[model samples]
Target: MSEEPPRRRTIRDVAKAAGVSISTASNALNGIGRTNPETREKVRRIAEQIGFRPNALARSLLTKRSHSIGIITNDTYGRLTLPMTAGVSEALVDHGVSAFLCATNNDPRLAQLHLEALLDKQVDGIIFTATRADLTPPIDLTRLAIPVVYAFAIGPPTAPTFIPDDAQGARLAVQHLLDRGYRRILHITGLEDYLAAQLRAETYRDLAGAELDVLFGEWTEEWGHEAVRLVMERGGDLPEAIFCGSDEIARGVIDALRDRGLKVPEDVAVVGFDNWRVIATQTRPPLTTIDMELKELGRRAGLAMLDLTRGLPVEPGITRLPCSLVVRRSCGA
Candidate 1:
């Protein structure tokens, strides 16, 4: 006689084995509906023993939750994600939620494509990191079925957002310089149109007043070098100190200052932002700067998503995280 095909195990099989009704078995397995604790455990154990794996697609049809979160950004996805992405991913995993990340390469079309893909995948929520001020969001972010949170910067159409308080960050750096008794401060920052760059420069101007000598340029070590050159070219009337928008710029400033036969701190105190660990402490005489806490920012974004999923309310509008000053040998502390 030909061997009979094996019978597929279903909720009926589990229910019979656990001495429960089919409805009770299904409820126990899905954690829906009410069932006695003992019966629920018994049904679950029977299903496990029978090697029964519920179809997730079918389950999703019954329950709208897909238990996934998507993150979309514009720019060098790798460089920008950095510590921020790791923080957000880690937090989501801890809650048994999966995360999807996509980069737009600063292209609006690519950004829109990624956004649509994530939406079609039925992600529970989305986090968008805007590239620039003019960039518009693909969806009516406020009308999406999923919750959306904006990070690092804002795009067109307001939504829940979080961004580094560059003004506060610069304030922290400037306060550090002042606390060390450095007046006549010079600032080397990124392009003036950049929100972060503009904020940092403005904050320094507000606090430093006439003492502030601002230099505009790209966020590169090259700019830092030229800033010092500008100081020297000003007929040897150098500022008492320097504040750089980035650690790279700070590095250039340090090189140029040393080349001019000047001593850091002892000659011109220097401070920068973005407490880039590799670039900061690794230097001969470590540099002082403001820490942006990008990773913490990512983690906060993840937590905000979680709150939204659970129907918890967050403070409406943009939220700013505090920045801390990291003192090193560069600034006379």
Candidate 2:
């Protein structure tokens, strides 16, 4: 007996069952062009009954739209990029798009390699996060005919981007402290080379408009502890409030301050950023901070990148999202 042709239910099979033309069945399945509503419904019902799944590979070969995007991040699994990438992935799912994730580890060679791989995968677009915006990635991505967007950080000049309003977040934190009747406030933040840290520092200085003392270091808890030590070593001139760049740093500040016989909110107030649960809730007294809305940042970036891929006019510049101060026991706000 002749072997039955491999039982692949094609669009023709669906159209035959639904009593519709092949083109009409295609239109209904792909949601392309226009088709009669009743006929479309009938075609879909018939297609479902026959277990007809559209061949995405064949469809992509025809239309050249892979319905996928690549996300290249500085870190792989944890850190700030995790939430942001998750948000972007969530948004992509809503839009019927897939995400291909790649970790660059903030290395130029690796980032370039990953970029090439994503390009080869024919991703509709790309979203890249880098360690330093000014580091000048050497990836020559101009050959790829796809849109690229940056999220939570800026990439090369050839892409549109979105980043949290760090300066605004800092301003919100400092303003809250000042409004709470705290004059001697200390700023504990990351290195000045980082754009986010620099912006926060500048905004604090601008808002304070005075010779304010700032303690700058990396984003680690060690820096936070060191800031407190420096303050204690300087004697009774300790600030009435401390503004930290991240929740990790804030946790360190809390430990150091408590160990040195100072009462939070009673002797000094503290404010942090990122609004992470581990640092905000896990501490002895819950920490107050500015919520940067990381997930929303990723979602917006995904939408913007899709727009770019469609040859639609995207606002070719930085898009800033709103941030807010989350009041907790830390700042006594």
Candidate 3:
């Protein structure tokens, strides 16, 4: 058995209560037609007192714009996109814009469907994001009438793509070890094909020196352990420090070192990329890692899209925000 819904409050009721015509009530509630400030405030106060709720469809029809935006992503794991989405949402909420997320899960067809549905709903804008900064979104956003922004993922050539500066992030890590007076640095990182890995590795070589070795493997804890094994099999003293591509790998590095009766920071200082706090903070001595600031990237992306919708001047093309080091105990000072 379904229960009956409560009677909805309307403008006519609000007008009667405020002693004004229905037309005047609508104008005051909508902030249009230059209504007298005192009268407008009185109408609004009465409207609130009676719990009056304006119709969204009616408001949109009058405003010619929807106050909602869509977020489309294929980040199967929320690790990267969640914080990014939070940032964008925070920025949009202040501007009276609401965001709804549509997860594509790497399915191209589903992504297209989501995009179409958002368009049908008359969303003011859309944001495309993903787990990888370099991977293109599964959907093609060609010639869409509404404003769109890319964050934590790559988009079209001319699209405003916001991502962390991976090269700088890598440089910051390697330089941290160097500044701590460690010259014999070792680099262990994720797959070679990932742009993030490539950029970080390239910068590591530049800052850690070309002669120092870099071990490329999966972005996993097992790979970190294996990397340590390989280093030991070479039959030499371990490097003064190791710079890993991710916090997961860093944890494995720390664990493997412990198994070999080695002390972190005391035996070998270790640093990692991605301040993934779940793993980073849980590490034995905690992890000193680079933060990509995905939220800040998302915030910027949100603001940029709003500016675009308003026909404001927004710089086009890719925008790489800076990543900073989140200090922890693993690196000793």
* Per-model CA lDDT versus the true structure: 0.80, 0.82, 0.90
Report the poorest 10 consecutive residues by lDDT, candidate 3. 133-142
- List the candidate numbers ranked by TM-score, top first: 3, 2, 1
Across 1-333, the per-residue lDDT of candidate 3 in tens digits comes to: 999987899999999999999999999988889789999999999999999998999999987888899999997688888999899988898767888899999999999999999999999989999878777778778589888899988777677889899999998999899998998999999999899999998899888886667899999999999999888889866788999999989999999999999999999999989999999999999999999999899999999988987788888788899999998999997
Q: Please write out the lDDT profile of model 2 over residues 1-333, one tens digit for every residue.
A: 898877989999999998888999998877676888888888889898999988989777766788899988776555667778788887778666889888877677998888888878889998876544444444655456778787876655556778888888999999999998888888899887888888888898887655557778988888888888887887777788889998989989998988888888888899999899877998768999999888888889888877877789887777779888899998774
lDDT of 3 at 215: 95
* Deviating ranges (above 4 Å) for candidate 3: 1-6, 16-21, 36-46
lDDT of 2 at 78: 55
lDDT sort, best first: 3, 2, 1
Q: Which candidate tops lDDT?
A: 3
| CA displacement after TM-score superposition, residue 253 of candidate 1 (Å) | 0.9
Listed per model in order, the count of residue pairs whose N, CA or C atoms clash below 3 Å is 0, 0, 0
User: Distance (Å) between predicted and true CA of 124, model 3?
Assistant: 1.6
1 or 3, which is superior by lDDT? 3
Give every collision pair in model 3: none
Q: What's the TM for model 2?
A: 0.90
Query: In model 2, where do residues sit more than 4 Å from their true spots?
Result: 1-13, 45-51, 131-135, 156-158
